[model samples]
Target: MVVQQYRDGGGARAVRALAVAGVIAVTAGCFGGEGESGASDGSGRSVAADRPLDLLGRAADVLVEAGGAETRTSMETAAGGTRVTIRGQGAYDFRRQMGRLKVVLPEDAAGADGHRPITELLAPGALYMKNRGAGVPDDKWVRIDTTALKDGNLLTGGVTDPMAAAELLRGAADVTYAGKSELAGVTVHHYRGVADLGRAARAASPQSRGALSAAAKGFSKDAVPFDAYLDEDGRLRKVRHRFTFSSEGPEVSVVSTLLLYGFGLPVTVTLPDEDAIYTGEIRQG
Candidate 1:
């Protein structure tokens, strides 16, 4: 698939901002307050002390076992001194490594509303985006190879792939139990740690390894700080990751958050036909 180029202009700037800003965000007021500490039971404490890494490493597996779930994602970052937020709602089939998301970008500089939401299809190694708004045809979908992206589609996709986010836990290190918390009325164990991208790539499943490997080399640092909340069943309910992107200018900070619920939900995602994909060059903005 050919990468869509952007033509220079206000529209192009908005598109570029979406691409760069999609890669990172800060989580502020995205979740409920952290409940009081020391709320875990004896068993929970034992598990936390004995094998936090082991438990965290299996987050993806737990999701897979649960079949599918609904997802909500938030990406927030600052651009040109103004804060931008991108929100997404979707559903994922963990067993098939397929999902669909409706991603809404922030208003443009002029504060104009009514920008169409982008539809994103998530597959094992590819990302399909429609309504991308870089001069591409309305019916054409832009296909991107996740493994080819520097950030491994994590940051580039606006919202991090939920499964990829879980697989990242495979590299959890220096993990510490941060007490207990309530997320949407469910009690969960809160854990904080830094994940090594290289290690995560090696430990991730075949479907996620390549993209994670790309991200390991793409980011300024391989160690990603995170906070994770898991339910009693060891399933991840919510996770927040902090990432930094650096270029010729100052480093850009990003915080990406994913929340999962309604396990066992039916999720169906169909990839577009080859003819439906946009193969033409997208002019740079």
Candidate 2:
């Protein structure tokens, strides 16, 4: 067995994340049965392609009418080419004044018991991560704080910037009408999008100008562009993306599983290592 014992330290968190990422990709692949290579017919044939969307820009407008949560798995690779996977659970609830998501690792994750993870709430523009575990504090979590992270659903958060997430996919090509398939039982049409990190870094921040100035400087030169596959309808089912760091190439495989389609308002996020919980009335403005 390739047992990587991660002792408590700076490297422990990263190692744990990387190990779990590998397992989740393998597991998600088995569950959805979708991939870059579209499904074939009995005659060894593939589905026909759809027309390009130059008129409206993208093949479809998932962000056209926003009001629900979208959930899926996520995999992020490192600059040194290390793959890290996370079972992403996310939602978009404008009504709740928030859109949020969380990634949970399966049992096999090296430090599954020690690594702290939690919600980064988009409602109040505050970070929310799960830190309350077997014996951990409730506030400790690896995070990047951002008010825009709470602005809109991550799916369309960069909608204004078509090529924003292009660099997220490394050494990968975008396929238009690559094929049609079902994810979480929902049929969606697929399209591939790409943008250079240099170009992406120049795009304006949808929320504000000052923040964009700060974020633009740190943009990586080689962020892998992502391959987003949608069903016949218009929902993002899967993204074949690997982090392409200026240092490392395509390093992670992320498969997103979207369930309970629609908004996750009053979304029920399960607490780890616990079976009991409670809540008070959701005070809203």
Candidate 3:
């Protein structure tokens, strides 16, 4: 779930809209199954038996070289024994740090017709949303300063930024080669570890540093557990990160998953004009 806090007049107001709902509850699950154990590292040695911190750390660099790719994202959160998953699909330009996604919220969040797919533009430090319900006009866009979000828009956007997700791996530590696995008909190397968001911020590119740095401090903990899959070419084919937020009542758990494919795809993202942004008060749930 997503929680958006923006300043109106001289005070800040929190909007718990259905499209960008605030965190309620979540439960983290372990990563296991799928793929064999003790796979060979191409030299008669078991790759899974070795810790490949360097390989995991370079995952972002590899994506940058790939130019761009089509992306699919899934975020699952549970509240009061009910779980909802938000799904998105789009393309991302890794080099430019820009992308476009159409995110769909579950029907239960809104009435059947009200849960229209929201168009989101992901840029350096801001997020633009269209069809963002919460007393928002259909023709106007809601612009959010990602830096101001407590989670740095990581969890607030419902879908994690693909580029940011890859960059987070730069701080991978205590990583272990899980084994070889087949994802979407392609073989990939699976690795599991915990990433230091603070370290990743320092190593991230200029476009992502500030947002990641803010995320490092906003989350319940800086160390985020993840499962990353990279192909032989070193490109990040898939990644899953578990985040916990404890700023309010109980700790909230969120599982963010990103999948990348169709490399070298052309992607175009344009930001909205100042006049197109909504500056009025956003109604709360």
Candidate 4:
């Protein structure tokens, strides 16, 4: 929410870099190959090769075919000299382009309840938010029109479409295999690379003008490094990115991690009662 205020000039650039960096992390993958044109299995079908773009392309295809998945993200950063940790778990339906995510708010900013967790349910036309824990009146849900919000506002941009992860597959360079590793019990091939943010921004869908792309454009033109992992089938399993933003202000280091699993899993999404939804202006949490 604090990031929404920074829409132009210096601050906006910072937001863009941070947002785009996250996108690159979510979209990278693992494989073994040397060329950029295509990296395929011996059978000739793409199987998430080592080349950055090739691997991501294959992983995106696998995710698309899976229909739906659950994602967990862990973020660590320092803001105004204070360290923060935010954790989120949610499910997305690729077919409907909808998702629901619940995040455990950081303790540093926790209100009376010590940790007021927030949950969001996203649909094409509207957004819903529920703050749980303490001091909530009647526990009513706040509703906001998806069209009214500024592009890349964290609340709206963060979870609009689960399938939007595919957009991260763009603008990869300096790709190479990092090695082998195990994540959550599955064997995976690891790969690392840098993102060409400008290229990625240009390739982004019109609706993708959100925080990540904008911030990415604000950073140095040099490609930012990122890492990703994939299973034997080319399904992206994990990813991580770390960088420091130091252009216009104090240097802030960001470490972001994304874990994708439970592919094709059915998830039920429950919309709040209309009577309990507030259509009026809602303040940022």
Candidate 5:
């Protein structure tokens, strides 16, 4: 962490500048067993290739066959002089482009009474959010017509889709095998590399693609540093990435971790009642 101060020309006013770097760790939770684990056969076979890019491709294949996965993501961000932390748990159906999620907010983000978790359900054409205990009607859910979005705003909302995340695994550089380790009671291979954000932006979800495209204009084309773990079945158990972005003054650093599991398992998603939905509501940052 580093901080700098600048005195305005009036001398009576002063402005402080800060730059912070942090690593946010996201924990993995099991839903149901659906597939095997590891890049190499559990018996005694060794990895044919140690390249991170190659291993990512194998992970991508396994994810495709698995259909979708359950994930828990946590992010900590600091910019200017403020810091915010967000954590969420969810399940996404890659093939169906659907998901259900619950996001936990920090105490500082609470309303007049207190903070309450927000529940969300997303699908191809629609998105619904329910803010439990937020002084709203019990059955009143907010709905957004996803197909009507002219610009992809939903993707940039800090939600990670399993398929979108898998697509961004390509074009890795500075690959290094960090050896093997135990993740969630299972032995796995650990690897680290730089993620190609340009490629990732193009492959991410529509909202993320648009957000990345705009954000990229103000930053370098350098790859973001990332770490990943693969199981015996060549499946990606966890992946983490961290990067800093700057434009004119303050710089903001973001750390994102994605966990993939419950492969080939069933994910049941039921939308809210139409009569109970408020279609005009929008989430505010």
Candidate 6:
């Protein structure tokens, strides 16, 4: 993939303002779904030694080992801010392959989807990319001011794994099984993820330096996402989610479509109050 560098989205935005931005909210502990908060109601929860917990643990292991993109919907929700959503298609091969991602916003959406296609392939530092099919992308791919794309939180590669997702939420959220519910025709088990703003930030601290452990504990958790995962047949299927941001408006409660298991490729997105989010063929090099 050849990335033409045009500095408009600033650090990342300017590098490739080719798509609507993503703001990530990563919180603490464990893997999969959100952690329940508040004192226990005493009705009993998934005991650590129970079959459900064991099954969940096995499922979590499957997710980590499988390590392929299972489709993803990244959303941003800020207090009194506009809401923006970006769904990535194609499996995410963090260390090997370049992932193809698409960007979109709800029609007349609270926040505008900067009509751009992120033809950018993920690398280490440079956020350079190309919109291979920019001129004729799908309808949800609306264009917005380049400034709205400012923020690296939208990059899900660093800590989007299930372990990291669960760790961020479990650190402060109480863990429990919400029984079972039917969603999109799948028998789903829900985990309540109470936003532990602080814990999430701590878990997001980049790999600690050999001697910089001192600074690690003080790292900010303000950037971690508060989201939940919906599982089907013991596999992490969709994200029951919303984010914690300042300028991205409204809490969007939605179910995401995941494909290819752990690779980060999301073929479709089901928004709670809007149309489905999807992308056409992404000729990603």
For every candidate, C-alpha RMSD to the true structure in Å? 7.9, 12.0, 8.2, 9.2, 9.5, 13.0
Q: Give lDDT per model, in order.
A: 0.76, 0.34, 0.73, 0.54, 0.54, 0.33
* Candidate 4 lDDT by residue in tens digits, 31-124: 1021133345688544445355676645545665667789887666554555555677898765565678886655543423455566778665
Residue lDDT tens for model 1, 64-121: 9988999999877543454567889999999998999999877662135777888999
After superposition, candidate 4 runs with Cα above 4 Å error: 1-50, 124-127, 132-138, 143-166, 201-224, 243-248, 271-275, 280-285
TM-score of 3: 0.83
TM-score, prediction 4? 0.68
How many Å off is the CA of 27 in candidate 1? 31
Model 5 misses residue 12 by how many Å?
Answer: 22
Judging by lDDT against the true structure, name the best candidate.
Answer: 1
Write model 6 residue lDDT over 38-138, tens digit each, in one string: 22246554222133334433443445434445445444323223333445554444223224444443333313344444433332222222332333323
The sequence of per-residue lDDT tens digits that candidate 3 reaches over residues 43-144 is 986664464677776777778888889999998764334456788999999888899999888776654556788888999998888877655667877777
Query: Model 2, 1-285: lDDT tens per residue?
Result: 011111222333333434442211111111111122234455655433433233113312332233354645454433234444455556644333344565555445545564544443443222333432433244333222232321112221111111123212222234355555565667654555553333333442243222233323333333334456544433344555333213132322322223325532354432232222111111111
Q: Which ten residues in a row have the lowest lDDT in candidate 4?
A: 23-32
Candidate number that wins on lDDT, 2 or 4: 4
Question: TM-score: which is higher, 2 or 4?
Answer: 4
Error of 2 at 202 (Å): 5.2
Clashes of 2: 27
Ranking by lDDT: 1, 3, 5, 4, 2, 6
TM-score of each: 0.84, 0.50, 0.83, 0.68, 0.67, 0.45
Candidate 3: 10-residue stretch with minimal lDDT = 24-33
1 or 4: which has the higher lDDT?
1
Against the true structure, whose TM-score is highest? 1
